[model samples]
Target: MILSVPLSLGGLIATAPSARAVPSMARQTGYECSKCHTVFPELTPYGRRFKLGAFADSSEKWDERPWTQRLPFSAALQGSRTSTSDTAAGGTGSSDFPQNDKTILQTAAIYYGGKIMDNAGALVQYNYDGIEKRWGVEMFDARYANGVTVAGREMTYGVTLNNSPTVSDIYNSTPAWGFPHTGSAATQMPAASIVDMTLASKVSGVGVYGMWDDLLYFELANYRTAKTGFFRFMALGQSWNSDELAGSVVEGNSPYWRLALQKEWGPHSVAVGTYGLVSRLKQDANVPSLGANRYRDIAYDLNYQFISGEHSASSRLTWINERQRRNNAVISEGLASNSINTLKTLRIDAHYYFRRQWGGGVQYFRTTGSTDELLYNTGDSLMGSTNGSPNTKGWIAEINYLPVTNVKLALRYTWFQQFNGASTDYVPGRNASDNNSLFLMGWVLF
Candidate 1:
């Protein structure tokens, strides 16, 4: 059977390759990849169940142990072509991307994923970035879980150790694994939320999470900088830079949390959830002396799915609100007339599948935030905001085909309604629409 599902990137969400499905976990459980994912990384109810089951190692044959259970290894590569309404200036001298209609080998990776022991399982991704010309850790999610009876209801509880906040989520609705899975790394994007996008690769986190009666989910965790120097070697990270490991270190104990309520009846499943992150951070390596900045981010999300016979469908909605206290930045950078600022983002997406081989979807995304000229001034360039606002609004439409189950092909177009707070004359002669982009991608897993 083929899967017609929305292809998404590391939050970007897009399509991938399809084939006989012997990628990683399938090699361990002997279950075809389709049993868990209609689209790679997107989970079926059974896939969620498998993860809650500790990847099912306790159920394996008695003679099998982690070391002998097929190794759980796989590799994949990606390439893409990107065309913008306006081309970047001059040549691709940045060494991180290609120029104009040039297609690039964007990325390649090797993964060690699936069951680690009777009660523990993990997923580790080591990737080489064609743009950065460096290799380091990309993603890691390790968990240990157990089943219990609670007031006659069944529950699955687990502990998670990972590098990013939402990397261990079974649902694809979160920031860590939402759709539009890949894009040209060289493309220029407006500035993003520091709280949500940063601290992703630089820190190590540990948390406790649980699913109760298959209806309620909760988690709590703390994060700190992954130690530099030798820790990078362990991550295949560049050995030359130590400070890069921590980036801007998390001050004190940065806390993160998640909560959700879900229900399923007949062929439909739905969920509503809330999550948050709060961190105290030192400025940058150059100015730690200025003290710390505080960021508090809160989000609400919803997910829906319908499955019957040869077809499956799903949709997700999410919104995030961030409150920031910029004591150090206000004093040192003098960019703020006020000491507090806020940022908000909203995304809504829906998809439909037919016959399990083809699919299409649409997404609307908008970001808006406080205005502070000193903080966002980019000097009349298309990349900078004409005003001191963090406003961007756009729409994306996509079509995807999964010939088998391990590969995906897709075409995506994004239209900008507003960029960096302007709909017209963002730069001297450029409107945000001038930066509209068309991206074509090919992705595969084996």
Candidate 2:
């Protein structure tokens, strides 16, 4: 059965028996992921048991017939604003200029999660954009897992229906589940719009493969790019000769892949992984300025965690190697272009919980690039370009309060700056200087 409801930008539904509940409910029941998961996000023997229990809890014999009849639903609402330096030009064209002051409804979503039968379950979500006046699917995952044997050893095969980013946010790193995080740098990744809320398959074909008792875990996938035209807005005009516009369609085979591994010894756990994309495209002959036939990137990340009682601390390091190859024809023609370009970034974040209700943390990020090739079309003959290459940095500090179990409220302040040697005459001016921005957001799940 399908149901719809108006929701806050970031709200999420609760249908599964294991659905998150109010803190009071959690305390009253005295249960945590540990009761189900072997290692927090990773399910364990008890975790599977809880899933089975969720199905049992919704049986016809249960007293809450209405709630048990369907799945749990959740929703979230969010608003954001920004401030920047006047030195920055919005991009190409007068229309592209970003207004110095702005307010936006960042997100609104609805989700359903629960079991379908004894050994199967599903998770589905829909997101609406107030500004766009449209709704789209964000996540639809169906999973099945059972004991099995491989190479004469015991193992399990689990399947999933969506291709969410492998590692985007640290706090809500469930991969294919959860509401949008308004304050994560990884959200800018290209895969954000393509993978989420699509009919992509993994697990049996592309999934973590290893023995349950092994100290390490790993994953592999036959990654396929999502359909083109899925995003709400296309930056470039519908001109076939426009290199910037035509290059936006990153369809065909992903040539993209991911690898993740982690090990736990006592109270310490460590994880490392890499994910990136490689693709080839045809450029418009009319627009000789755009260069390159192939674009590729490689990224690596490492994480460490120390857990003890209510106190926990974690840190992460990530590096990216992005390359844009220049087309010989374009360079010889003397159009605005470069040969090879690359971008690298490093970020560190940490969080500490106080009694599981209140917590505080900070995150820092630094990005350096070989060239300024990443550009977005914003319509009205305008484009948005990153002003700096070689260096950009940002930081976020926040405190979270969870009055009830399933709900969370947070306040955060962020600052970011970009340095550019030359600016353009778009909305503002050329020779852009570093700019700073601040934002505050609140999130909840029910």
Candidate 3:
């Protein structure tokens, strides 16, 4: 039984901060990267505010001329090498490509992003996957924000048009922008949940979000199924697959909700937040479904950062529990033993930056859930389950060195404790350790 992951984008068991004056926001505001990011993506206090404002703030003279005049365009290139403990079982595309072969041009992307008007800003990406040999709409967001007062408290409210739920978020601590920034598209992981693993590029979403008193944040949004043709609108090209889409095919509209509270004083800042979504989805797009398979996923997150002098430190933790009602799958497909199931995922990471040049971080991830024999009963095949289980755990450690303000070099190693639900006898003859991997990559944004 093959289940479709809801998001076209996944944590990828795989897998740029703009540094310096990114010509985009920096040129528009005359502010340097240090004013917004300690390292790209990782935000400073002011950076968060800038994002909350929809990247529309500027201290420089407003050029009434078309932004096309300034040409705030940029591109990113990634080169990486992947090494596994054991040779992979040949499958599709580069899934079985040589591991220690010459470095691959993992990915390439171009963007036309940044403020379009005083109250509007956009960040759109066009990506080309070298391994899959495909073009895709990586991420797209267009926002309209304004300053307002809600009940006597300072507030910033905005309406966002985006391709995914968390892609419009101000903080990078959430699942969509979590650590491991980039991973080998070739790496494989065990069974996954709809919320944590998928749900990035498969659907379209629009929501209203805002922050009040610099302590409270809330958002309300809805998502619907999207097709490959939509990418042409952003000039991001097309989808990787022509058959069925990579994200959940929803019925009607799916509701998404998020809330957070934060505090800051001196050089320390901390925040706690909750986000969830209720989706009614189906597996096959070609065939009609008996009924919608329902998934209600709820999550909690915590982020803490402290910056003082030349030293900076930060930590992020997120946990999600997804409740599944498999009535449709059981009645129509007979692929599940139980009418209900549950899946859970937890991730934690910490990073330290020395003098804003060298950085190191460690991350741990775990996934577990109740299983149905039909869903987790098979062998060592790519989609098989050695045992009737959906469980996996691993550790990732990485180090980074900035060769320049806009470029970074990184090395990461991942060790597996359990794969496909077990450590030993995980399959007929293989051990989980065989999946351990090492990845080295170079990332840049300008």
Candidate 4:
């Protein structure tokens, strides 16, 4: 079936590789994986440029490449075990850890990624979520990029069509490529901002971006629900079914924008950027008469990288502020207690690596927002807030050992200092620390 799909598409689907770090790219460009990454999935300056160029850069002649080289296919597998500090209330540990202390194959994915033409490239992934027991199209990014001289300054411009907002971004500070690259399928954080992963894989976006003098960058795009047209094919096998999306329809095109300034000096590189989105969506597709809910999200981030021989280090800081206006009519309908609410998130992390084989990192994250019982409280002890406050604070620490460039083993711990606005008794008797978890994970790419 996989072979049939590519054959049916013919040359339309050509040599492509993984979106994250994979060997197919190295084989095509005649460079080692380290040339483009400080570690697996973490890009260095050169790696960022390679992606900004639409992954079209290559060392060999395109027409002369062999069939094997032309089909840059790769597969990835992930396994992990998660253990919480304490069992769930009533000994029903399944609520907190469906497969606690059990090593399970969390994910398996196949990727077709790389340059399709002289000026075009793409990355497509089909994945299986072992935990969910489902298969789906995980991510897709296709682009047409080129370089030109604008006012004597070099400018690289491109148009990106993707299923997720930040999937096409070159910076790791963004949501898609942010830290804690891999997570336990057994557990999850409760609160997240709208700009986080809320719209990932749920909508399609078409954006135009440009980088000037390798110093300034800008992008603008519009997104719409991916229920029909080409987007439907791109979004095939999504986690959300059509009926689920129907209840929260994106009424019209949502606008997204980005701007950034970056510089590199010797072994040090730095980037500062801002990005945002504005959308109006149907509060309830069941009630066509109700007004739409409006959301506005704004974010700023900073990234820094240092590289010297076998030593590499990086840091990222990002903050997102979101304002939501619930439909007044819906509020009156007992759907919400407040017509307007706000949520904000902050994340900071630092990482260090020695020879790209051994690495460690730490991350601090926090989410704070308005309190509204109808909106934030669900009455569930483990996954919900008892005080109607959307506040969570935590830190993650991890260490990794890579036997090879394509295989990684990591040990990580997450500690929650506060949850749902309180450190102790956040719920009736459960404390935030009860959710602290330890995770051990392994990955293989070939």
Candidate 5:
């Protein structure tokens, strides 16, 4: 018998102050982080001027190729199209005849980053799914740092559980070159069915991060898996039997947290933050009315960036609070129970860049919730009444192009609408005012 795994030393002691305040753009500009991260998990400004020139390096000037043995690769390509009048049954049904509105090839990814020592570094990703032919592992990051000891003590650190970030198109505001690449009824929730609303390529856990200087940034995590699973009749389409999902078991402890504050004065840069997640669940004697669930979410975001030269602009806003609870339920034949669920969201995004390889953007989202007051019961004959109203809205528009500088091309359009003023014709014969639809996409990066 041999099985042992345990190595997280608080995410390797928080990667030593951003690895001793940045050095090695391969030691100055020998480049990596994909020469500005189209996706090494997103970042650009020549990767933020190789991270603000590794936090203001003495005065700049270091490119003589320090550790050059070579290794860094990247690639991406995408496509899309959609215009609709709403139609549904099993899947891939609307697009209103005409061979379903055309245009495809969604996502393709390939990545690699460098440095094995001299402090440590790594970033790897591989994804290819031409409509699910499969090829996974979307992320991996490893870091370490320790330098600068007196003078206000500068520090940086790291430890990652891959899959990184918030995942829904990376920190909400949607549109990462969109389409039906998952809609946003205020960040996913159309009574949530369709496999509990996709997107969340991965999340495994193990974080211990830090940053001190640009005004503090922090993280402390635990996560232990969550690709997505939290069911409770998903509005009412029923299908949750695998002993009732949610964390599937491995004991407990699932905390996650984050905090941030950033600064830059010249061209103006700002950041504000908060992050969250807390979970616990267990108990299912063959789902005896099922219970024992607890979940939480909290968020806050603000960003601003504008640089002249070729021109650039960015603006963002996000706020969310999601909660869930169940605590031991059996409720009848023997009695035992509890319940509560909640959701609230708001998002806004905008971007603009010209001549530095064309660009455009826009996004808006809103959500409201509260329903399921015992959605159904038939002890007396037929008692099925559940209606809680809270509207939902979504919108997106985008365009991008960069012929070279590590290739990029994009186009996107999306719209979704939901109103619970209670109306049902159940689509058996059509026209209940046909809901709404329109999604389009196209992308390529390398």
Candidate 6:
């Protein structure tokens, strides 16, 4: 069975921080990358505040001039090798794990980030996926921010326009900036929460947010599928498959909301937050008259960081639960076993770095959901779930070394304990461990 939701946006497995670690951001603030990052893309408290302020704060008076003078541009390149425990049976070069045991250029990307005006700023990105062999805009965020006093307390508020739901968030605990920051594009992970980068680069959003007394943060936003000419232009001519579009059509706009509380004392910082998305989509893009399917995804998360002298460490936890109302998926689409089903995802990660030069981290992840044979029971060995269950659990361990502030090398390994429905013979003869992988990478930014 094939189920397409209007904002499916392909798999989120390959999503990375296009705007994070941009050298231009460091130049703009007159600070080293360490000022904003504990590790390259992970933000420090000051980094979060910089983003919350719309990236407008600057150290140079010349920032008031035209952006061209500042040369607010940066680029990134990546190369990696992937090795899976077992290649799919009968698999060839074009099959699953195409680059298994092979090294290849993984990505090439260009970024633009700076203050558009005194009160406005934006981060835009366009990149090439070496594995998919495609070039398109994958990240864009424009904002206007200002500060005000409310009840004698400092309040920072802003308006944001961007692609991707959590792209504008200041926390790395969310999907957009979550752990396992980088992964092999040639490898595929099964099962993900609908709210976890599922709609990234596939939709456009507008939001308003405020941070009061540096204590509470709240945001409200709405998103719509980017399928039309104008919206597609906003997405920088990203292409969509005709059949894929015809399979799942967005009915209308979806609402996304966020709330968080943060506190910092000396060298310790902590945050707790909740966010959600509600979407209504046409069950069949070909048969809009069939009505729509409703998806409600809610998540709770926690973030903590410790920084002192040459040591820095952070930890994150995120749990998501999605309630599905298969209005037409059951009868009209025949893609679900029940009218209502619930899916849940949990992730926990932590890492420590010394002088921003060396570090290692680990992540524990799992996903479980209601069984629906019609939707998940495909006989395909590699991507199938013989038992019609959506249950998967895994652990990832990684070690990193930075030769310089702009260059990094990493070795990471993923171990799967459960996949699809089982650890042993999830399919006819393949065990989940068969998909375990080791990835080595080199990433450079300038």
Ranking by lDDT: 6, 4, 3, 1, 5, 2
TM-score of 4: 0.91
Where does model 3 exceed 4 Å of error? Answer: 1-12, 16-23, 61-68, 88-102, 194-197, 228-247, 329-332, 378-380
Clashing pairs in 6: none
lDDT of each: 0.67, 0.40, 0.70, 0.74, 0.42, 0.77
Candidate 4 C-alpha lDDT tens digits along 292-408: 788788899999999999999999998888887877787888766788888777889999999999988999988787887776566666656677777878898989999988998
Candidate number that wins on lDDT, 2 or 6: 6
Per-residue lDDT tens digits for candidate 3, residues 57-99, read 7765646556556665778887888777765432223344354
Number of clashes recorded per candidate: 26, 30, 6, 4, 16, 0
User: Which portions of model 1 show Cα errors greater than 4 Å?
Assistant: 1-22, 57-69, 88-99, 229-248
Superior by lDDT: candidate 1 or candidate 4:
4
Residue-wise C-alpha lDDT for candidate 1, range 332-368, written one tens digit per residue: 6774544777777788998876756688778898878
- Per-residue lDDT for 1-446 in model 2, tens only? 00001010011110101112212112222455334322223233333333323322233433234544344455655454444333234433223224324565545666655555554554554655433335655444445545566656655445443443342112222223222234321111110012111212211113332334333333344333333344222111123343423443333444445555667687677767766656544344345454335557676777666666665555666656666565686456543246565555455666666556667667675555554333221111122234323344556576666675445565655554332312233223432232333444444555
Q: What shift in Å separates residue 189 of candidate 3 from its native position after superposition? A: 1.9
- Which one wins by TM-score: 2 or 6? 6
Best by lDDT: 6
List candidate 6 segments past 4 Å from native: 1-19, 64-67, 89-94, 191-196, 242-249, 284-291
Residue range 153-214, candidate 5, lDDT tens digits: 66555554433333211222222211122221111113311111111233345566666665
Candidate 3 whole-model C-alpha lDDT, 0 to 1: 0.70
- Extract clashing residue pairs from model 4: 16-113, 16-114, 17-113, 17-114
- Write down the lDDT that model 5 would get: 0.42
